[model samples]
Target: MRTPLGGNNLTAQQYESYPSADDTWTVSFNNSAGTSGTYEVYAVCLPATQAP
Candidate 1:
């Protein structure tokens, strides 16, 4: 992001994600920028198959 006077308002993004044994995901993020912005979150899932 850019400021009015040609300054950088952008900050480095830090995040982590992992799946738990219970088949759930944990998502974490840091907002170092201290600014609110629009973000879109989505996921594409597939059925789990058993190993015969």
Candidate 2:
């Protein structure tokens, strides 16, 4: 998490995964200060043949 001001007080409160062919995770964050920022998440995808 990147906060423009008021310091970085981002915490991952909870995480959940969905049941599907493609796995996906949902993350919840707690920012008590309500600071303006961007929350970014990334996932790695590999082809069936490339994955071991």
C-alpha lDDT values of all predictions: 0.54, 0.52
Model 2 per-residue lDDT tens digits across residues 1-52: 3334445665443354333456764545665656556666555666567556
TM values, all candidates: 0.46, 0.37
Clashes of each: 0, 0
The local lDDT score (0 to 100) that residue 33 gets in candidate 1 is 81
| lDDT by residue for model 1 (1-52), tens | 2223335464435376666546676555665887665444444458899999
TM-score of 2: 0.37
Return the top candidate by lDDT. 1
Q: Which portions of model 1 miss their true places by more than 4 Å?
A: 1-26
Q: Tell me which residue pairs clash in candidate 2.
A: none
